[model samples]
Target: MRMPYRVVGGTLVAALLAQLAGCGTLFWPERRGQIEGRVDPVIAVLDAIGLLFYIIPGVIAFGVDIATGAIYLPGGTHAQVDPATLRPAVQPDGTVNRARLQAILQQQLGRHLPLDDPRLIEHRGSPEQLAAYGLVPAA
Candidate 1:
């Protein structure tokens, strides 16, 4: 008789790969309260059962980075905000509208990068403007 477990095992491995391939959004830090209804129950059950092994540490690190006011998520650096979008956040009063800046930056980059982030300071002010604010631009 043919080996029966090979068929079952192969199907399980394929399903697992498919589930992981689609989990990109599920792990993103910005997906809170929005991404929903697409879970594979099999994967969900497997993940739930194995959560402590790897997922818990990742979640804890995400939480700690959030508490620290980090500009990006914990894994790696993301691209800087486009200077085009950053330009308009300058208000008529000549101050950066930090609230507006935060919203735009979050939408464009999926991270809460601050206007004063080093990556952003050059985009925000001319040399004279930065001096007026008692700030210096990096070369």
Candidate 2:
């Protein structure tokens, strides 16, 4: 005896739906809020596989993953540094007090900052750009 077409199809559809239900959020909750980071290829491929079974559910899975930022790789652009921690290093002269900053960083981070390292870049933004971000450059 063979299974009826409807029963076989229903079983296959149910199994596929179960596989698709494991969206990126369910798999990688820790990766949430990483909107601008790289997409996790594993999740991307898994979501794409859903497209083979059904277009709408696959698209929805992709949409949910992207919107919730669960599809992104953690700790790329998602890593945030607190500006308040470095505020003490900015001098009235509109320059960074490297010695003071290094000392503060050492105390807080438990590591020595190479103040004179050439790899450390200082970006002086334009006044207009600063204004756009609601920041005022020290006069």
Candidate 3:
């Protein structure tokens, strides 16, 4: 009993493509659930797949879970803060007070974000605030 050449070729091609796609990231571990504090979703799903010996559904579930927004999006131009009313004056070095900036962000965003981290507050200068600071928007 031998498989057809076409069947074998198709299987080989599919396996090669799957390997090239780097499916490992799909199974990457998420943090332990706060409730259980021990069950790792990724590992649990993977272990279930091992028991079932069916990879497709496991891979699909893993991809869906990982692609979900567990990560925060970087705040860009839309996140810029108004300097005047916010009351955080930029210093000579073009930096604002960390605490003041955090306060303003909390007020505007209605949540406490880590503004002390430059990454969160980078590119956060508002044009209206700049105008009040005697600066004009670059055309």
Candidate 4:
């Protein structure tokens, strides 16, 4: 009667929806239709129902697997997942703080090769600096 037709119509609608949401087993049997590690709520519920309904495929696959001696290789129907990662963000901005940098540079360089006089350092590379420091005129 009317009850029979009602049930049939409802079953058809549910089946169509299940297919649309990627339910059922075999192939992309999404444990959950997850996006970025979080499963869609509707899909999550559908997935649970799908798991229950999947007994059909699960049984068939069992037979096929036993016949074929087992194989269930996931090929791209799987979701790629990674946890949120945090790392230091550093950059070399590339601007030489001329005065401060040069001062530190000169200080460090002095540690390895001591400059004779602080005065010669001021007029660096001048003939007078070289003569006073005994580098050019004095070998």
TM-score of 1: 0.30
From the highest TM-score down, the ranking of the candidates is 2, 3, 1, 4
Model 4 lDDT tens row, 35-100: 122223443454445445555633444443323322323234432222111001111332224444
Better of 2 and 4 by lDDT: 2
Q: In what order do the candidates fall by lDDT, top score first?
A: 2, 1, 3, 4
lDDT of each: 0.50, 0.73, 0.48, 0.38
The residue pairs found clashing in candidate 3 are none
Clashes of each: 0, 0, 0, 0
> In terms of TM-score, which candidate is strongest?
2
Model 3 vs. true fold: TM? 0.36
Q: Write one digit per residue (lDDT tens) for candidate 1, span 1-139.
A: 3567888778767655544432323444353322123433433444443344356533543343333323132343547766667767766456667888888889988876555543331335577966665545556
Give the per-residue lDDT of model 3 (tens digit) for 1-139.
3669889888767654544343333343332111112334544444345334346655564444334422212233346565565544445445567777667777787766665433231355677966667665554
Deviation of model 1 at 9, angstroms = 65
**Candidate achieving the largest lDDT:** 2
In angstroms, the error of model 2 at 29 is 1.3
How does residue 96 of candidate 1 score in lDDT? 68
What is the alpha-carbon lDDT for the whole of candidate 2?
Answer: 0.73
Error of 1 at 130 (Å): 5.8
| Cα shift from native, residue 78, model 3 (Å) | 7.8
Q: If scored against the real structure, what TM-score would every candidate get? A: 0.30, 0.49, 0.36, 0.23
